[model samples]
Target: MNQDALSRELALRIGLAARALPDTDAKRLLAVLADCTGMPMTESQLANIDLATLKAAGQGEFAKVADDVLQQALDILKNTASEKILPAVQPYEEGEMPNSVRIACASDDAIHVNGHFGGCTWFMVYQVNSEEARLIDIRATDIPAGLVVDDKNIYRAEQIQDCKVVYVASVGGPAAAKIVKLGIHPMRLEAVASLADIISQLQQVMAGSPPPWLAKAMGIEVSERFKFDREAVG
Candidate 1:
């Protein structure tokens, strides 16, 4: 079922539901819903969908997904609208932090790094140096109509092209490769964690001696990057 055929409210619900599941989008979800609930799914019919029907429609697609995640998706489908709590973005300016690296974090909620790279609702960007980190911006991943899944990844990568590193709860191999090709390093933390904790750890690493790859990302010269390790050895 194409989004155009559905009411604006139903379309939003489907989009939210799709984002709740890993590596899924509205178009794909609509196909699954059509196959399971019968074609030409209507607003009232979708609102009545149950978890069992959703699971049957998944056909093992949700096998690895947590029960809570599925429940969240179901909630989106059942409700007309759900409130989204997001962290407030701090003020920032270009050249605010010299020698800092910009990081992109895939997140559904603003407070946690709990999103899959391909289907995440938001990318919370931060500018970080050894001393501090600041939330710079939040970019939404809104897929345009008729775009395929592969193109979705490309579009997401482009959204954070200026970031030096990207952190996600999960990322597919193909999506990881695409981010890498764009000069963005992709890091995974499959379990949900507070974004503050993750950023704290990153600051600790930077304050001491960052790994070579991280150093490179901060624009440090390759030859000078190992000085900390060498000094400790000596």
Candidate 2:
């Protein structure tokens, strides 16, 4: 991205980290902004940033994302906030698409889908549109061990019901049944695989001629063709 886009990007990052992370971590997020800006910022400078002031002044690199967009985002977040405002993991790598789908990965780290369905705590949520695949949030599930099978299965399914697809290393019969009951598709992948690459493959599936199951998973009507370029299908 050009400097103009970079500035807007950093400002958005600040808005997200500022809204989601603690004050200290938000202060440290300045380092990320600094890294993008190619300049070093002192803690004193970062510590002094007030949301309203920064929202209004929008000085220097922060100017591009100024006014309504950033302001609205900043107003909605707090450290004690329970609701999640989806976070961006990566910038759009390809051209942005008009339609997108959300997926959940059963994993410990957000970078890999390698966790057992029953025992995993972290659910890496991602939004995948035609143009890009980006991380949105890392959701936590509190299905305690020693719960009965049905209860734990329902808890696991409930945690990711918002997602249309879920990737995991393994899924118990009961857990998979509950997930299917919720109308979310369960997929088994290798214990360790690149999350980005997996998202990319899904992107490709959407881009090319996807199978009936995949097309249905994406909620695309088969009659639509979904812009699939037959020639591009290898």
Candidate 3:
């Protein structure tokens, strides 16, 4: 299908739906759309789509794609007003709060670690220490119109270079390695979770004795971590 055949609104909807699915691009999604709703895709056909029809259409190429992901994509196709509400960022400055490490979360809803590292729409950054955690920034993953990125994973990693840790619902091994090489620890969650809950758990670990890796991320030497306890006993 010629890209020029799609109206601007239809094109935008297709683009958004494709982005919602992991490892899928506009061209691939267009093929699937053709199979589901016929060629010369239109807003009227998309608006009438059901999850059952989408699943049947996707069984060949998108069989491995999760139902939730398919549903999200379908939702975008159905609703022109499908904008996700982003959380507000609080004020923060470098070195303003000592002993805190910046953490990045791959999230689409701004409330949960629900996005794959490579495909997430936003990186919700938080400033966290042993005592508290606060949302500091929200970084969009959309590349600028003219800027070309050769390696998307590397570009994503560069976006959070200042962060000490990154949490995601999923990430490829190669992408994880790239993030690790940049001195940022990549943590893949087994299940979707609230960002606030994850931060609370991190704070708990920090309040006690952190493991060697966590210690390093927090810039605390393992040897010096228990010095205060030893001194009080002496």
Candidate 3, RMSD to the unseen true structure:
13.5
- The lDDT values for all models are 0.78, 0.61, 0.79
Error (Å) of candidate 1 at residue 43 is 35
Tell me the alpha-carbon RMSD of every candidate.
13.8, 12.3, 13.5
Model 3 per-residue lDDT tens digits across residues 1-234: 111222554566778889999999989988888888787665446656777777667556777789989888877765423575444566887777667789999987655678899999899898888886768888999888999999999999999999999999999999999999999999999987767668878889888888777877777887688787779999
Q: What is the per-residue lDDT of model 1 for residues 101-170, given as tens digits with 9 covering 90 to 100?
A: 9999998755568899998889999999987787778899997677666687989999999999999999
TM-score of candidate 2 versus the correct structure, residues matched by position: 0.53
lDDT tens string, model 2, 89-170?
4544323544567789886543357678887657887778666666666777775566555587687788788888999988
| Best TM-score among the predictions, by candidate number | 3
Span of ten consecutive residues with least summed lDDT in model 1: 1-10
Over 4 Å off in model 1, which ranges? Answer: 1-81, 145-150, 231-234
